[model samples]
Target: MRELRILRPIAKLEDAAVLDPVVREVHRVVDAVLKPRALEDLLHGVPAGHPMHPALVLVPAGSWIGAAVLDVVPGASRASRTLIGVGVLAAAPAIAAGWADWARSRRQQQRVGVVHAAANESAWVLYTASWLARRAGHDGFGKVLALAGFGLVGFGGYLGGHLGYRQAVGANHADAVVQRFPTGWHELGVLDDLPEEAPVRIEVAGEPLFVLRRGSRVDVLADVSTHLGEPLSDGRIDDPGHRGATITSSLGSVFEVATGEVVHGPATAPAVRFETRINGELIEVRLPRS
Candidate 1:
């Protein structure tokens, strides 16, 4: 299908270098404030196993959209004001989660995200003002502001859709690894040739795999990160001697080397792991039977 003409300009926003300074500053600030590893992981949706921002966004967007509908209804002023206030308040945490996710995204995604965030923030501000205006008995003015804010919400939502779908932000880049390989066991390399407790990158059927040899057991995972396709083999390993060594992506997502489970976010999906068995000196790996 031909691309929509309207999207041409929006897509060009990815190359706008003007947004970089602001993006850098926001990244620094977010990194500083979300200093606690645990809290950062939570905001990144590590525990939820997917990005929380998308779900959290529904609350404020739904509330404000509902208020917009109620504004035209006679005798619904009180209820509309209540919904506006709820939307304004709920926007805070959603914004926090969004910024956290954006901070770790690729440059192209960040450029588009900056504008997306600006639009949403503007909407939030307008909604906040609308709530205050309504409380002060300026119902007509408040209704006008709410309507305007909802327009920005729609625009921002469109940009967010572009980011999440078009740009492939927050997608599981390694999700197709297992599918790319044939079902039977494939030889990776000799077990003794793999350096101990170090990440090794191997290619089988043209797909990169992250292999780690610790003591007698070997752990294998898709080399591409589930978050943004960063190379897992290039990342550092934590607790390499432990039962399950942890691998932190170049972009800060963490995963357990043993189980392929995400240990921290920016990565929501688990890495693709392979079941391994030694065929004498040759190491063979295959997708675990589910």
Candidate 2:
């Protein structure tokens, strides 16, 4: 069964070093074309706090599946053709969102995504031809094309699932790790450990956090960037904003360490803020939810 799985090539393709530049150039084009933050977010699913491609894909997948059902019915040929046309239309937006996300994913993920997209696009072309053939009264040829297209789409979907679930392209990176911090305050050793206006990574109850101290006032936020779960402590602290000094994540999302509000961000979610109180010699912290 392992040998029979055609979709296994997607995993193998991740190790194909030859295609790296092709993938990089494609991502560069996507980033260059989708320059506006809002436009990029719309395709990336930032508003939904998850990747948007999966949601958009449902339209094409659904329309095709519905058309397949109609294809076998005696009086449903016209309806099937119509549904196929709808699927073709839906594929446009789905592919757009997918390309947008592919730009933001890790290199390895983008490698696998390239083949996955090719397979889907091949299926889309086949399906489009099949629809046109059916409309032109080439019923026998249309059936064969439909079957081929369906097989391609199914294999492509299997690869897409691998990309999403196995490679972890769009997973929420911070939620589980940051939620483990204990309620109420505990000592973080000496207050001197935190440097002024620098984001320092500290482990609190096994949960990683960023500590930024400005004079006597100390601020802490979850160390993970809400955008891609990159380490926020590895980011830089900029000049003061209205709420507090701004910390820029590795992905260029900006957050205020004091209040955890987004000053300018690729992430819609605010950095999780921790309330800090200096108790004499020890620095104490507590989860805001607690």
Candidate 3:
């Protein structure tokens, strides 16, 4: 419910005339600088499909939790503190990965993400202060700092949940197999009207399809990219290789397409393949529907 409420304030702020300039500047910063590279890498997955952020979170969380437990134990040693330090250090890369992912989102999403990042950053600062205080023999101050850091981490985690479940950032919409075409083939349209070396938008049974004409054959795919709902037809075709073609979106995200294989990140699945007849010849291609 809080997540749902957060969107209300974001929407209301959008309507205020005074906020336009500030919002525009923020948009420019994100779009012009942060997006082109950081976002692309985040979505592309530096560690395969596994995002770096979630992987990194284990470090800090595990470290702090271990430290807290050590504090309560009867025979806790300096080694425990050292372990905590190691965990905190390990968490840094994950945080960087998550931030890179967040930087590329829409302004509204970025606004929420910024707060989320701030909360986590503050937690890290507090944790670091706690570590220093403990090492300096200020046990009380160290415990207090650790508690404060824990509280901040909790708040940050809450915001993260909202971003993921409510805003749907870094989520794959196509993961759910909502509907599937029948095993048998379905007709799209007359092949003659489709242009050569151009992506043509078409509909089959009310499903949007991106049809690419290559010589007499065609390559069809769902018009919408699985990642961020970007339009596939808007993407350009790249060189033919093991990566058959690269579809570049307006957002600067590139999707690789193989001859018979599903393209790389963003889109998790292969485009639906369709076999149809053109000029009395059987042609195989991929197209989108529903």
Candidate 4:
């Protein structure tokens, strides 16, 4: 089946050269400003186990939408203005969370994301203006501005939905590995060839894997980052011991080497881990039983 007509141009935005300059600058700025590991993890929702932007967005979205409803009702001017003010205030953190998530996404997703952010920022500006106008007793003008802002919000929301559902921007990339991989033990390679305390890339069972050996124990995980599919083998291995070892992806996601638990974000999903054993000189791996 063919894709929707509107999606053709939107999809083309992935390769749009016009956005490269802006995307680069925004990326630099965001990375510089959100340099603190703790802050970035919080924004990416590491503690929450998923992206936080979507949930944070509901506050401002609901407030602005509720304001729109109140605007049309008689004797509701004060309530509508209050709601608009509330939306303006609530939009700050939501925008921050969205930016944090966007900063770490792939170029294609970032292309759409930049436009999404622009639209939302424009809407926010309008809402802020509307609130100020209402405070200044310009009720009719405030209503007009609020309506325009709401329109931009709808457009921005559509782009956000496209980024998530269609483009798989914030989805867990490694969630399906176990489902498709064959069950039971599969031979990986000779145990002696597997370097000690170092990550190695191996292709087996139709998937790329990150293999790390420490003495008798071996830790295996899908080689793809759960955030954006950056090669986990290219990432830095920290505390390369059997216990408390972690791998930090190039894009700044940290995962526990043994259990595949996400230690940081922009990655909320754990890597696909494998159970390992040694058959003499040979190494074997299988998906761990749930």
**How does each model score on TM-score?**
0.96, 0.86, 0.77, 0.93
Model 1 scores a C-alpha lDDT of 0.91
Give the TM-score comparing model 4 with the true structure, all chains together: 0.93
Q: Please, what are the lDDT tens digits per residue for candidate 4 over residues 1-290?
A: 98789767876777888998999999999999899989999988989988999999999999999999999999899999999989899999999899999998888889999999999999999999999999999999999999999999998998999999988887888877777888899999998888889889999989899999998788999999888888899999998975989999998889999899998899988889998888988999998883
**Model 4 worst lDDT run, 10 consecutive residues:** 6-15
Query: In candidate 2, which residue pairs clash?
Result: none
Query: What's the true lDDT of residue 1 in model 1?
Result: 100
**Tens-digit lDDT track of model 2 for 10-95:** 67877888879899888788888889877877777766756678889999899898988887899888888888889989999899
> 199, model 4: CA deviation in Å?
1.6
Backbone clash pairs for candidate 1 read none
Worst 10 residues of 2 by lDDT: 1-10
Q: Comparing 2 and 3 by TM-score, which wins?
A: 2
Candidate 1 wrongly placed segments (more than 4 Å)? none
Q: Estimate, for each residue in 22-99, the C-alpha lDDT of model 1 and write its tens digit.
A: 999988998898888888788888898888899899999999989999999999999999999999889998999999
What local distance difference test score does each model get?
A: 0.91, 0.79, 0.62, 0.91
- Badly placed stretches (over 4 Å) of model 3 are 1-47, 77-80, 176-183, 239-243, 259-290
| Best candidate, TM-score | 1
| Candidate order, TM-score descending | 1, 4, 2, 3
lDDT of 3 by residue, 29-97 (tens): 644654455454654463365455665787778887787778777767475567557766876776666
